[model samples]
Target: MGMGGMRRQGSDFEPEFFRIFRSIEDQQKRSAWLQAEGMLAAAPMLRARGLPLAADDPGEVSLEAERAAAEQQMLEALVRSGVPFLLAGPSLAAWTLYPEPGRRPRESMDLMIHARAVNDARAILRDEDFVPDPRGATRTESAQAWRRSKASVQLSIRLRWDFCDHPILNRRFSIAGLQAKSVVIEKPVAGLRALGVEHATLYSALRWVDAVHERFRLVDLFDQDLRWRMLGKEKLAELALLARQRGVAGILAEHLGMARRVFGTPVSTELLHSLKQSGNHERSGSLLGAGRGRMRYHLLGALYGRGLRVRGRHLFSLISPG
Candidate 1:
């Protein structure tokens, strides 16, 4: 779902405020503010509304347990329905890449499925009482999401499930490719599948680029930085090769460069040089380059790329209180 459509009913800040915050040039200040807001403000606000703040927060322990149970239940349901899926995004990151506990409390769980199975997946979710989130939905895309909730501590806590038929980064990498490249995680949640660290790294980088055009979230940068730190140099070389094979080498390089600039991510110089030498970095480099290079042009282009209907919907949502 676009950030434009992701308003919480009781949020103190408008969704547009988040979009503006992302455009702030000061990375350190933005990260610090985000950390403070997440801990002192967003967590309490969400917890008061019966949302899970973090897996390790004492006040929200019950909510965390319920979320875990709900995730397992949903996974078991999908397994019974015979739908093939791999959990993606922050949920996977929390389990594998992220180092600290409760560091990233995801608001939703992202699932990737083959395009042909989307209807089946939707049916399964509906069977479990998940309803479509119209505010965050579009009719044409191969992506759809639903939300399910149960009463908790006088209010209700919600779990969101996002189903995507295409790779989260570039649509060119097919679901079959993702499935073939996925790795299995057996503990904490058995039979769980996730993208390999190399592929996941590339996805994280592309996701950062997406944030550059849409809404910037510090968590996105942190995910890349932490994952890069964990994956180290050899894995990055593998990621570079995978990006080349997937035809997203330039895009990968461009975002990696951005991560270095914005968060001081430690991408190896050799990998950067290798990617640039491949001659595929020009398109994304021109569009999402660091500092003052063509970012405004690209942002405008991205706004236009969302099309009139989506843009109008966002504007309308921004202005309407409901």
Candidate 2:
């Protein structure tokens, strides 16, 4: 359902705020402030109304446990090697939503590391024959090749190939002021494992760009929040503002929306307000009008246009005075 249909009653932030945030003009600054206000405002109102927010619930907690289990092993391995890495994309999301792996994974553990580290990771996995694709061609070509090979390998296990050598991969991995810190993931049978945070956050956001067709997963956002929390809300607010200035508010918003939809929680209002202020509403909307495949593409484009800006900001940050 659209944002309007998704609103649960008693939410202090009006659903309209989201709709407007999706389609506003020149109020990137204003929307962001309002978003923060709404979030701060929501807490008391929600408390007064006795409404429950989904930050930590049983199902979510269970899922996090499963994700944690799956992640710790991989992380501990990376840490042992002294790899300069960070958790990015689905893995972080899964970790946030469910800190341990379950009987099954909602999504594979995706990690983002400096470009220099890809070969290192590939080397580690190579003993198991998990080598990186050497097509040296565009991702589209690789995806096609993978599809052709799908008959031989389990499609899901092989899906990781499509993710290799992605253009966005570079941006997320080589972000300015990039840093790493360890997070613990639990393995029911194996004790604890360690993973990097910075890389994981970038990867998770980048994953949203490609996983356009997959079912929206809320756990990712929960992870984003957790990653953001680890990174510090101050940085999130700074990035949110920077993302807007770069014209990526729409992209960030869409991803934030996906997080809300999947996880049943809103992204930080402060971050939202910052993005809204950055996004010029006059230019936002369903650019493709209406069509079958077009809806996703249109929405994706609106978001990407904004994302390019955010990415651009990161690019600039990488070089700017610290």
Candidate 3:
């Protein structure tokens, strides 16, 4: 209980997610902002207060409908062509991870497949009018931007052969290992699957820590608390080992501490202590006690060579926000 209390007394690196969330004093305006940004990850909390949502414009609703239909067509094409894949990211997670999903609309959806079958999968998407994003290859996988030839489907599909897109970070997890633990989807979207609970916990933690943002990714970070709760105690013992083995224990532990600090995620006190005590550099107050910015740029860089280019890209964006 002592450890579970927020660790940072006065840290400048603290996330402003809830600070900004609470600052939105008017419930009406807050709901509108959430809807416009498609940050439906906050739906359960909003519903608890019985807040009325700002309605969508009819044009936007029509566009969303078209996108949904296009997405379904893309999925049907994949299934019909027998392209085995796993539905990933917020597209599925947002819909299924929480007690009541808000079906957050996505301009892009992610799916993973075997490297050998990437072309085959692309062909199926092409047949359905999707085309390779002209922006070209990613560090880890190819992308298929949904062709907005007529109605502006407002969709992009990522064809991933691996989970972590970072070249340096690719060693963290495996497509094969995650796929082995994947759970099948049965309704609304058939022939699709998502990461299992243990995997979701790790993946979400990784994303939380690895992410670099101008504005804190409020919805995704909010997801950390939810997924952490879903993880429960039975498998709690394995998370530290998994995090350690995958080389993310220190960084993930640090971010988990941040989550506990910020969100009051309702995880057991022992969890944070266990992660820090997992016998990584975390125990030495190296990564675990570091500030969020320091941990992101320095600890992760030294551990996995992740920061130089990423930091440069972020700086460039800051300098040129056009």
Candidate 4:
């Protein structure tokens, strides 16, 4: 989560620069101002609920600055921690395109943990005062939590099944493999950070890039593209080899296609055919409906051909074109 090349420079100071910056183009500055106003507007609500806004809260002007700094510190801390994590959502965006602090980050700090270690991670978080979400009826389900501090810093935790860590894929990874790819950062929050390329590549292939999923997130594709572009061919090959060894050849193949489509780098045909012949097909389409199931063949074929880009606003726009 250290600063990526996308951080905004002094030239982005103009309000108009934010307007065309994609996420903030339309109502970016307005949204930031709204958040400032909302904080101020909530005073009545807080008072009605016996939680009056502090008179010495430094008013809206200072409050925004304070909130931004607090969030930045938390991000720094996350980067410093040695825990395996990746910047997802708006955090990644902010890191990539250096946005103004007043522009609220849209995504939270999302970290991936092996499903098997979820219990252990939850235990660690609980000790830090993160209680499990009680919204669901079942108590013994997958773990999740959200916590906030008096300073207005927010934290969220979710335990999910990592598509790359599947038994099939794990078998081929080297001793250090994904574990060796982590880096330690010292900002926003300190923690272990994984290679953004690997994280984004795996994420797009497993979930976002596939035609089977309906969720269209151009940001995810763009993030993967950015990371992949930053990662030269050698690193991409190493990742491909790692995936192939893990028996997730198919996923990696698809990932390469996604990289080519979104980032404009074509993956080899040999790699594509190889993965299709290696991975388990049953687990691939379990979540997709029939239409999506049909879409895969076409997408796969197209991947073998020209490949697609992350741009455009079609159904495939939400997903990686390959």
- Top candidate (TM-score): 3
lDDT tens digits by residue: candidate 1, 177-214: 77898998763466777777886777666555543323
Best by lDDT: 3
lDDT score, candidate 1, position 132: 75
Least lDDT summed over 10 consecutive residues: which range in candidate 2? 141-150
Give candidate 3's whole-model lDDT. 0.58
Writing each residue's lDDT as its tens digit, candidate 4 over 126-182 gives: 555566544311111222434442325444444433432222222233323444665
- Point out where model 3 deviates above 4 Å: 1-20, 27-29, 32-37, 40-45, 49-69, 98-102, 134-150, 209-216, 282-322
- Consecutive 10-residue window with the lowest summed lDDT within model 3: 136-145
Ranking by lDDT: 3, 1, 4, 2
For all candidates, the clash counts are: 0, 43, 0, 42
Candidate 2 residues lying further than 4 Å off, grouped into runs, are: 1-71, 96-104, 128-177, 180-206, 221-236, 258-274, 281-322
User: What are the per-residue Cα lDDT tens digits for candidate 3 across 1-322?
Assistant: 0233455434453334455556688976776666665554445464554444444445544555566676666677677777778777666665575443334555466787777788888777777667666542332232334443344556778776766644345556677777887887764467667777666766666555433432344456566666776775666667767777766665566667656666656555566666666636433233234365422433344444345664454344344422
Window of ten residues with lowest summed lDDT in model 4: 1-10
Taking all chains together, each candidate's TM-score versus the true structure is 0.65, 0.49, 0.72, 0.48
RMSD of each: 10.6, 12.9, 6.2, 13.7
RMSD of 2: 12.9
Compared with the true structure, model 1 gives a TM-score of: 0.65
Model 2, 1-322: lDDT tens digits are: 2433333435554444344434545454533433333232122222333533323234433553544553464456656676554444454444443423331234344443554565666555443334343331222221211111222222111222223223323232232234424455443323233344433443455455544345543334445654554566665656565455434465465556555543344466555555655554513322211342324443334344335654453344334442
In TM-score terms, candidate 3 sits at 0.72
